[model samples]
Target chain A: MDIYDILFWVLSAIAVSCALGVILSRNPVNSVMFLILTFFAISGHYILMNAQFLAIVNVIVYAGAIMVLFLFVIMLMNLNADVEPQKGQLVQLAGVISGGVLFLVVLAGIKSARPVTIDKAASDIGLITNLGKVLFTKYVLPFEISSVLFLSAMIGAIVIGKKEDAKPIAPRDEEL
Target chain B: MPVNSTHYLFLSLLLFSIGIMGALMRRNAIIIFMCIELMLNAVNLLLVAFSKIYGDADAQLFVFFIMVVAAAEVAVGLAIIVMMYRKVHSVDINILNRLKH
Candidate 1:
């Protein structure tokens, strides 16, 4: 119909297709790239929803930071399509069946629900100033706690990922 | 001409389902992790849409919190994956059978 409607359709198509690419692409690297594309499309959807702040943050945190971390680990491991093991046929079938069932159920549920329309354009809730005010004032405790969680996560990642200086014992030697 | 909340809901549902399939079917640990991130993004999209509908900022704020937790989770989760790769020489989840005993 109009620009809003057209944008929504286009972005949703991009997101869903890219999501499929994430799963079906044999190369893990390509899969990561597809995931990043999906994030970008979802961020476009955020912009359409008038959440400008969230749209930016989604791009920054997801496509920018998290995906780069993924890429780093992927490259660090030197993963390739040849090395990725395939699941059994039956397992793959089951996964597809389950996912399809979920989609059908959720789709049916959504079809039955009444659509809520916004009579007016959305307010400034998505702006950085308003979001920051709420984050620091009303939600300050959780915000502070999340920082602590990040700290612990950083420490945990460093500890888990740190290379031990001790000469790595051979697996066979340890078994013996 | 205007997009309704239901439109966003359907989009989120599609993305989430794709994510579930990816997580279930993929053998690579990192790709599975990426699927989880995809699911989180789907939820973020839904939250922003709902916030727009309700004319409120809380849901958007919650999205922020979700993003924070997701980042931390990814950091620790990826580190764990790297550790597993070191031990097993592969990122295939099927190979991670040492804990079965």
Candidate 2:
């Protein structure tokens, strides 16, 4: 195998193993840590694909910020491995069937994909430069919409995270 | 033949399947959240591989959007998980079957 092949195998193994660890870890904090590792490995794969900006952003946004928030929640709640509900055989069977369908569909998709020759030497970046153009110019509406979504999510999270009060005031526009 | 785009496709498929397995089988809410992240990463891999194959940056850009969405999802999801924990004291999803209200 060539260098590319070896790197692919190694990176993918790290990604898959960390992903498994995310699911298998009993503690939520540890699971989030594993999830961060999974994101880091995937970032490495993006670097391998020559998307350096994407790799950096992936690490910063995912492994750095989002997962830190997750850890904060886990710790704030004081979740421990003990006192968690146990799994049942039915859950495993459901998992098996669901995973089986996902596997089948993906395998069929791979079989059906038409062969396409990839060009690796395209402009070293469409990352920060051209991607900004696409996001702002071509997909401007969607970008704005995403901002709105995030704003709403920020509000919703604030609302949810607030300490419970005696009564929450309903909006004026609600039914009188 | 040596491995190529097809192999990447298979790898992504397997990862997606594994994510599905985790989502379906795991009783913990945190584990389900992680599985969803894995599925998103699997899609990102497929997107990057296709971007390489097609000589396009659009897929890479989409990957950026996916990362953004995944971040938002985890933020909101964890917040809700915290809410659940406040009421129930456990994040294990298996015991959460009182949804008939």
Candidate 3:
């Protein structure tokens, strides 16, 4: 096996185990930590695939931003392992079984598919320069739309989280 | 054997299944939300792999869009969760069963 293969295996193992840790950890904080590790492992995979921009973005956005948001919410709620609710043993078992069955079904379905080998050499398409060109020239509309989406999401969160006042409104003389 | 598209496929599938299991097994709303993130990451990994395989940048760009949407989703979702907690004083989704009544 070459270095890429070894690196791929190492990252894959780390990713899978950390993903399990995310699910199995009792504490929400522990789960968030594990998820961060999992995201890092995935980012490593992105780098290995020569997607430099994606790798950086994955680290900055997923591991850095989104996970911190999760941790903040968990801390805001002050959740602890002792108070964490869990599914019953039977339900947990069923969940595991169903997930395994789905995995097996998909695995079997893809078993016969052709395995296209990736070029181990570097590709320039994933570079920031090329990606920016494509984004601004071809994908500019969607990019702007996403900014709008972000604005709406921000507004929605504020509206939803705002507390309602207890005082009732009095009828106006004009309305009367 | 050298790393190929199939290997990445397997990895992504395994991750996705684990995410599904987590979502199904967890009763905490935040944990469920994290599991959904895990599943989304799995799909992102797969998309990146395919992008490499086809020598295309579109899939990676798609992954970017997915991240954007995920961020927006997390913001709105966590706000809802916090609102729920404020109202019911618990993040346990079982408490939401009262909505059925």
Question: How high is the TM-score of chain A in each model?
Answer: 0.90, 0.84, 0.92
TM per candidate comes to 0.93, 0.88, 0.95
Ranking, TM-score, top scorer first: 3, 1, 2
Misplaced by over 4 Å in model 1 are: A119-122, A166-176
Worst 10 residues of 2 chain A by lDDT: A117-126
Best by TM-score: 3
lDDT of each: 0.88, 0.78, 0.93
Q: Tell me how many residue pairs clash in candidate 3.
A: 0
Docking quality tier of model 3: high
Q: Where is model 2 more than 4 Å wrong at Cα?
A: A115-117, A120-122, A166-176
Clashes of each: 0, 0, 0
lDDT of 2: 0.78
- Give the per-residue lDDT digits (tens) of candidate 3, residues B1-101: 98899999999999999999999999989989999999999999999999998999988889999999999999999999998998888888889987842
DockQ of each: 0.81, 0.61, 0.86
Tens-digit lDDT string for candidate 1 (B19-96): 999999988889899999999989988888888888889999999999999999999999999888887788888877
Query: How far is each candidate from the true structure, as Cα RMSD in Å?
Result: 2.4, 4.4, 3.7
TM-score for the first chain in candidate 3 comes to 0.92
